[model samples]
Target: MSDPIEAAIFEKLAKADPKNVGGKSIEPADVAKELQPEQWQRMLPKVKATALGLMRQGKLTITKKGKVVDPNNFRGVIRLRLPTEAETAAALAALPPVESSDDDFD
Candidate 1:
């Protein structure tokens, strides 16, 4: 199971406009404000952490200066967006090869 905040972050990023169309990207603060309008300031850190988690899972992208940055090493400002098709392919390719089970023969 995943945290609710993480899920919300993914949902928001997924619905955001494509970079090629409108060049839309979401700041962590934007999500924090949307999820917690009253205490948005307090939610910023949590929102950023959740966004990073999603990025690590290959379901999201974190960019700095319009280019993807290492999720493990970035600072200052960042934007969250759904991974481009090329990025998605690269991420999928980088995954460990799956092992087949004997049950598949049944």
Candidate 2:
């Protein structure tokens, strides 16, 4: 149920080898370019936001120098890749606990 751009980003990453296997990660520009070959530059911010959303969902990983970086606080060049098994586990663990509403008890 993802939008076209989000779908494109996932499709691109799904095709790339996981970074744990010596696969070269992709930059936001790469997805942006694929989504809009001519005006790809205009797509950078959207691409980045989508990537961050994916990472937060534990479906993706954002890394710098081969180490995962906090999605909320990152800068400079970064690479995107499908999260490895361990990364997925860690991401799931790092997620904030959800609280149920009191009304749910009714």
Candidate 3:
């Protein structure tokens, strides 16, 4: 399948993570700003979808209040990041996180 959007999201996440410390995480808007400063509104949903795909693949995690969340149904603000290696493989194999129903980025 085509994955240009996913690839771009992953790249931006990687670049953003070095600054992601103390449970702070990256938001889709951050990626959008870095990759599409002038078109963030258009780019955000795609970024969320791509991030969900990554989370399902065991490459990432979606969190709210520092806890892993059901990406498909979470509400309010959330953050995305690589899943900790210490987690069981099963934890990594859960259904993928879904795109947020509301805009969650600043």
Candidate 4:
């Protein structure tokens, strides 16, 4: 990915597992830290957007309070993680195309 924020988010998620994230889902702050440890807050929006892009692509899922939330319009705190194969496909099918070009990822 060309976007450093997206790459950082994926890098952290890629390490998700019992031994990595303690089986816990990742938050935008986590990816922000990877991108700019000294100022993670500034990276929050980009990280969140990247998470949304991944969700739209069937690679990630967004959740709030342990329940899946709509990727396009979720409010409040959110967590990110890889989705099950079926969930991924279903989520991808349910959403309309928010992105135009393949290179237009957030």
Model 1 stretches with alpha carbons more than 4 Å out: 18-23, 92-106
Better candidate by lDDT, 1 or 4: 4
- For residues 21-92, write the lDDT of model 1, one tens digit per residue: 535688888788888999998998898887776676677778899999876688878888887777767666
Which candidate model has the greater TM-score, 2 or 3? 2
Worst 10 residues of 3 by lDDT: 16-25
Encode model 4's per-residue lDDT on 1-106: one tens digit a residue. 7988877776777776645433358888888887889988998988888788888888877889988887768898999877878878897788776766667557
* TM-score, model 3 to reference: 0.67
Query: Distance (Å) between predicted and true CA of 14, model 3?
Result: 3.0
Best of the two (2, 4) by TM-score: 2
Better of 1 and 2 by lDDT: 2
Question: Worst ten-residue run, lDDT, model 2?
Answer: 15-24
lDDT of 2 by residue, 44-88 (tens): 889888888888878888999999998879998888887878878
- Flag the better candidate by lDDT, 2 or 3: 2
Ranking of all candidate structures by their lDDT, best first:
2, 4, 1, 3
Off by over 4 Å in 2: 18-24, 104-106
TM-score of each: 0.70, 0.80, 0.67, 0.76
For candidate 2, the per-residue lDDT at 96 reads 93
Whole-model lDDT for model 2 versus the true structure?
A: 0.82
Measured over all alpha carbons after superposition, the RMSD of each candidate to the real structure, in angstroms, is 3.6, 2.8, 11.9, 6.6
Runs with alpha carbons beyond 4 Å of true place in candidate 4: 18-23, 95-106
For candidate 4, what is the lDDT? Answer: 0.80
